[model samples]
Target: MQINREQLFRASCLSLLVTSLSFGIRAGILNKLGVDFQLDKAQLGSITATAFWGFPLAVVFGGFIVDVIGMKRLLVLAFLFHLAGILLTIFAQGFWTLYISTLLVGLANGTVEAACNPLVTSLYTDNKTTKLNHFHLWFPGGIVIGTLIVLLFNKIGLGWQVQVGVMLIPTLIYGYLFSRLDFPVTERVASGVSTGDMYKAILNPLFIFMFICMFGTAITELFTGQWIDVLLKNVTDNALLILTLDTGVMVIGRGFAKPVLKKISPQALLLISAILGAIGIYLLGTLTGNAVFFAAIIFGMGVCFFWPTMLGFVNTNMPETGALGLNLMGGAGMFAVSIYTMFMGSYYDRVVAEAHGNGAFAGQQILHTTLIIPCVLVVAFIGLNIYMKGRAKKSAAAVQV
Candidate 1:
């Protein structure tokens, strides 16, 4: 079979585009779904959070079997899942229907990550982190596309279901692209890293440390991005505008990642991301309209490097952990976001009621609560940077001997 890296990479990006399209459109339509079904914020959160929950489930499981079943099959499953989930969501009548549909979409999203992450690493072994960052640019890029589509559809009076159906376009394209391409083996198989070694590597203390940090990174990025509209409703009617602008910032940042990463280690970038994320979230909690855009940029720059950097760190530093390690890192993050999103919803309900329906206060309070995740990440990543630096030095010294 012939390999065309460009075609394969394009297929991966389109797959991710579908994934983010779901997120962007779904985030835009949460209020409508809630209003139509007459559900409370907590119930809305539950329905939406299923996507997060299902993401981890599929990614982790896909990680385990990707070597056996291959990236091609995982992606085929992704296309099917996306098809079922999106169509179901368009026709969903109520909570249970929406929940089941979203779970399917979430599983598809995770499967894309499961297949694409390892596939990218295999294709760009020389610069895994830089290339991964470039590939993940599509996540925010897709969001920007989806957001614009929604804004356009709303202007024309198209319903939420139509916005969701937009996902079908990219889904079919990527599925067909994958069907035509020849997939290389996962990096793990290609490198001859034994299955036993991969298992042992995941249990390493450093791998576990970074794995746990994924929870904080995921929540800081995904949770906050997912809830932007509600969180900033009192601050601005332009919340989606901020989402578009900041995610635009993310798209640009990832597009030019190679130059920045050349000057710093992935772990150092992670440390910087945590710091900026904390500052940005804090400002977001305290600021108002238009001013939120400034904070959004800082927040964008902070989180821009997070998802890919975390996976890149795993890919470059712990190659022995293989697809399992990468998938686990992603899954751990989604799991945290899923649980916290539900908690944030309930917290919003409680605080808003206490304040006699002051939603801005409730939103600010939730931002403050979520702040702890990134704050902890700052300290943890600092430690991670130091530890990784020392390890690199030790390896360099050994090589010189």
Candidate 2:
């Protein structure tokens, strides 16, 4: 059957947009849920953590099986889970209900990444890195849209449920788009690579190293991103606006990745990003006044390419691992966020109590503590950059022989 790659790309981007919209709205509403449910920061963190745990579970499993069951079936499951999750969240009465519903949404979000990452790479084989960056632009794009919706709803005094319901619009759009599309065979299957080989590729020491790096990158970007609203609430009354500005910078930065990559190798990019991220996080933790916005801009630029660039590096350098590699990389990242979300929540709660319920001081302290995640990335990525460069020189020398 003939397929239109452009149409498929659009469908995939829309699917991701739905995923990002759901995430943005969920993050925006965390405070509301706490007040309504009489939950503490730790409880709210647990609720937020649930939103990420299901992602790694589904992506790792789905990544292994996506080729066998096909992308179409997986996307269908994602659509249904998204629909059900939204309905459940709207009617949720307490923590358990919200937790289960958020898990379903996370599963849906994971499935979308599992299917679409491979799909996008397959469609744009010649320009995987550049196209992947373009594809992920919608993440921040959707966040911008979601943030605007929340602000609009807030202005009209609409409840959080209504903000969540707004996700349904894109949800239904992507479902229809996906249902009408045809999926291509994954690059691994199309190349006749054995399933055993795919699994073995993941065990390589280099893959393991990259996987560890992915965890740090994920925590640096998503852990801070998920909690941005709450952490910055005391920093500025215009927290959502700040969130919007942060993502807005990401949108622009990602759009320019192709140009940026022409000058810097992916490993070098990761190394530089880790350094910038560490600096930004430290500034965010310790600095105040108007400098918070400056710090956010630095952090945004640092994270703009972290997720997609990491995936692109793996895919480009380790094409033998295929979808499983991408899935595991993505899953590891999400799982890191899940673990840190709970930890940060608990840590914030403890610090707030010690500071006599001074959320501002507690937030600053928490950010200070969180700076360690990015600082570790700085050292790790430096080693990775040096190692990757050595590997590249050897491969180039071998090719010349």
Candidate 3:
């Protein structure tokens, strides 16, 4: 089979676009679901958490099997799951039904990442980091698209179900693209790297450290991204607009990562991002009115490159771990969001009840609590940056010898 790398990359971007659209639309409609179903923050949180839970499970499992069964098959399964999930969501009656449908959607989302991350890396070997940043541009780009769709639906006085159903359009388009495409062998298998070596690569201290840091990074980005509407509900009626603006900055930042990488090393970039992210999250907790938008811009820049940069770092620095390694890194991030989503929901419930349904108070309390995640990331990234610099110096010294 002939390979057209550009076609495959575009198809991968489309798949990610669908995934982010579903995610963004779901975030936009959480309040509507609460009103329709008479559910509390915790219950709604459970529904959101199901999506995150399903993501890690499918991603990790798909990572293990993607090489054996191939990327194309996993993507086919993802499309089917997405179709079923969206249909089920449109007709969902209560919590259990919504939970099941969202779980399926989350599985589909994870499958796309599990397959496409490795696929993109394989296609652009010389410029893995920059190309990955380019590919991930769709994540935020899709969020912006989904946000606009929701706003349009609101303007027309349409319901949330219709907004979700609109995702089916892109879902079908990507399925068609994948049907005609071919995938390359995973780098690990192509290099004849043994399964034992892959396992050993994950056990390396540096990889272990980075995997732990991913948990914090994921929580900092996704937990906040997923719940921004709820967290800022009182501050602005246009929370989805704020969400769109936040991701809009991400789209622009990631689009320029290629040139930026030439000036700043990836490790230095991570360190700088962690510091800014910590500050941005803290400012978000304290800000109000129009000032929140400025804080969101800071937060967006902080998280814009975290996910792909981390994945690119692992892929570049620990190539021996291959697809499985990338899968684990991606899975770890989703799993963190899964746990934190529920925690944030429960926190909101408790705080709101204590304040007697004071939306502003509840929102601020949750933001303050979430701040700890990014603060921890600051310390972790500092250590990682120092370790990487020392490693680079040692390698250079060895070459001179």
lDDT-best of 1 and 3: 1
| TM-score to true structure, per model | 0.99, 0.98, 0.99
Clashing pairs in 1: none
lDDT per residue, candidate 3, 1-401, as tens digits? Answer: 89999999999999999999987898889989999999899999999999898999999999899889999999999999999999999999999999999999999999999999999989987888888999998999998898888889989999999999999998999999999987899888888999889989999998998899999888988888889999998987777888898899999999999999999988888888888888888877788888888899999999999999999999999999898989899999999999989988988888888999898889888888878878888888888888888999999999999
User: How big is the positional error of residue 62 in model 3, measured in Å on the Cα after superposition?
Assistant: 0.7
Q: Scored by Cα lDDT, where does model 2 land? A: 0.88
**Pick by lDDT: which candidate is best?**
1
lDDT of 2 by residue, 87-202 (tens): 99999999999999999999999999999999989998888888899999899888878888888898999999999998888889989988887788998898898999988999
* Clash pairs detected, candidate 3: none
The TM-score measured for candidate 1 stands at: 0.99
Local distance difference test, candidate 1: 0.92
- What tens-digit string does per-residue lDDT give for candidate 1 at 1-401? 89899999989999999999888888888887888899899998998899999999999999999999999999999999999999999999999999999999999999999999999999999989999999999999998988888888988999998899988888999999999899999989999999999999999998899889999999999999989988898889988878888799899999989999999888899999999999999988989978999999999999999999999988788899989999999999999999999988899999999999999999899999889889999999989878888888999999999
Cα shift from native, residue 263, model 1 (Å): 0.8
Misplaced by over 4 Å in model 3 are: none
- Note the Cα lDDT for every prediction shown: 0.92, 0.88, 0.90
lDDT of 3 at 373: 78
**TM-score between model 2 and native:** 0.98
